[model samples]
Target chain A: MSELLSAEIQNCIEGPVVKYGYLSEQIDVVATPQSGLTSSTTGNRVMTDTISEAQNPKSFLLAIEALERGL
Target chain B: MILGLFVGESFAELSVAESTPSSRGTLREHQRWYLPKHGLKAYLQNWLTKTPHKPERVIVSSRFLYKLAGHRLGGSVAQIVTSGFENWSHFASLPANTRSTSLRQLNRCPSLSSQDLIFAVHERILSDGSIGKPLDLSEIGAIHEKLQVLGLKKVCLHFHNSNLNSIHQQQTRDFLVTLGYEIFEPPVVDAFPSLEPFTRWKTNTLSAAVSGTFEESMKEIFEGLSAQIKEEQIFFFDGDLRLHQGEPLYRLSSLFALEACLYSQLSKIMNTKMKSEKPLTFLHFGIEHFSYLTDEKTLTESPWGTLALGTQGCRDFSIQPSSLLDLHDDGSLVTKGNLSYEPGPIHLGRGHKPLVADLLIQETKWPEIIDLDEKQARTSLDRWVLLMQTWQRSVKKLRFLANLLSVCFEIK
Candidate 1:
């Protein structure tokens, strides 16, 4: 894992920053167009999944569509 | 040459004119690009590369598109909350039997952002609104670099007692601004200037959730346009095509309000019975679907509850705020898996789908344009009518059965 991501999870410890909740993290990092999706932060207890690099995040496209529905 | 780059939900058009509108004609050549099944950024880059025009002046009539798509096309707003309260948004809406008054029905919704996307920043503002613990800038810098690599540049920040002190959020905002992140500063509602911390955070969070994606998309577009066309004076259109200065807006709820205010008068919204069904995305035709990943919860998924922004935001669309003929396709038509549905130029009639507003930006078309597939339109309407009829019949039957059961179960 790169130092950048590690720093975030490292700071996410027992304090005012890290909340008391389930710690299930899944970050679909678009490493590159060709690299598709990689487990960039999976080792830091974060799971990584590969998705189509070309399309917007599934939910984002939906959100826009929903907001602009009709007009 | 004067150039017009018109962007819409599903199509983009670049029109160039060698002279003024009154002299001969303003449109020498025009080309429309349809969004292929993937990579909007790639598609836009390809579109710009293929356009063989060098524009000295450019006018953009995006209006509503930018506000709705505030983040990168597919990017989400990375949410940051002060420590220990990450789940405040995640679980704030459940009926509080602790309210001490009464309870009502509500949807068990997800927060604007998913847990994975939300990060915790170390900062604390005391109940008395004092800076109890100063913000940790190092942590923010690390997060910035991490997000930079992933091409995510928007942040929705909330700190403890932000409304009271607002110092931590302000400092964090200033820091993120320096780092080039499009921070959606939780707004101060015009009516409620001294808004409580929770209210302010909620307002800002909703805005970020909705408009964050377009931030990246517009940035890419601006960069793409600059690399392609060296136009110095560029003007962007507002909700009603009114030219405005400044960057794209992050407050989608306000933009929607403007659209509703202007177009609602013309739309047939009086018939509540007919408008109940949020007009099923015109049978999902021309709807863009990005449902490859399902498990990850999106901003539109839960906490905000399907296009609602609480008391401060636009009322839920279910109230039929706008036209009855609304074709807003909110992921209702995601093709089961991925289909080979490709969109191309509308004039050539290359595709079967009917993505509207292809030629809308052109002044010649004014408020009317885009070729709708007659066959697709008919099929979609037929299907919708059939679905509604079936739904109405079922509802009537259910109501009758309920009435009968109520009477039978009465203590006579």
Candidate 2:
């Protein structure tokens, strides 16, 4: 992860998170490039899935692990 | 060359004078649908988390999800609520035990409200329910106060309905302006969507029978209702453009038509209203699809919904096409006159056929004198060119990335 995306993910994790009424102490960051070739094909899709997975922490970690294998 | 933005789907087409190669270059380079489908969650999350900069005044036509947007946008959100006083079990899920009262029925509808930066649309009453009733000024005043408390920076009222002449519609406009709201009347066109991607099947023959400035009509309406609604608070927006919503396939076509009207109207509106500030692109929730995106899965699926095509912005079209203004595919500005539509070759496959209205802009610009006030015309043309260039560049960038990814995978 580049410094900027890593930072953004970190911020999403550390900052106050209130989405659909879920509260989290620590949120993991999954960084994806928006511009590169990898991104044009699948990056946005992966990121969307990750955010959704993070909706429930248990599934989020499992999804992240599964996603990493594809990468 | 005079640059006219023609917004409509397959039926309506724009024509531009073939003055310079740069003209074609400008149109080709600039054609884009600004709203991107991907990365909405990321984009919205980024927008909300950012520190509040300039507060936005938001107005919504529906009462569906003001709270969600309010929480996210963090400023104020206002609504111009409109409705027929009746049971709204379809829209508002009321408790079964609570015997529905007519007053409670009235409350179920959305009305016009404007916060500083955010403006809300008034719920549309298509039939006999809500038009012609004298609106309560207190209701208007109370809504304005709520908008103020919500940290609104500006207020604008947008109302759309089929009954253009009803007493209640007039009163709604009168009420909003009395509370210091900028009221605009958008141009209304009646057209239906196409079933096939590229082909447009004009089932009903449509025309712009009347073409007078809606702003002028609004002034008359406001003045007529002035006996009930106070006069001092109302401000009129000129050359407002709104399109009729019906049919499904005409989604892209109607979108362009609305865009064209908005483009022309905004140019006039900004010049007259703001004087100094230019109008930034305003992203509105698609009128028909307002209720669709709450479920994340739907966002990724098809971008279907009435909000995308069925907007009750202006109530002008009827089934038999009577008692309304008609318009033509030609670039002429007709008001309060009848327009007629004749069937054309449906050869253009759905999505692939170059949009009729978009093409018309190029064709229309081709013959007309692009010359206006030397500086103003140049500035307008330049802005159009810049917008086109930005879109072309964005699409090109996306396509390039897609191709590169394809190559990399093939190499592997």
Interface RMSD of each: 23.4, 25.1
State how far residue A57 of model 2 sits from its true place (Å): 46
lDDT of 2 at B269: 33
Instruction: State the fraction of real interface contacts model 1 keeps.
Output: 0.00
Instruction: Determine which window of 10 residues in candidate 2 chain B has minimal summed lDDT.
Output: B200-209
lDDT of 1 by residue, B318-386 (tens): 100010121223312111111122332232244333221121111122112334456644555455445
The fnat of each candidate, in order, is: 0.00, 0.00
Predicted model with the maximum TM-score: 1
Q: Put down candidate 2 lDDT per residue, B311-384, tens digits, no spaces.
A: 32321111101111112234221222111111111111111111222222232331122122445435544554
Whole-model alpha-carbon lDDT for candidate 2:
0.25
Each model's chain A TM-score: 0.23, 0.21
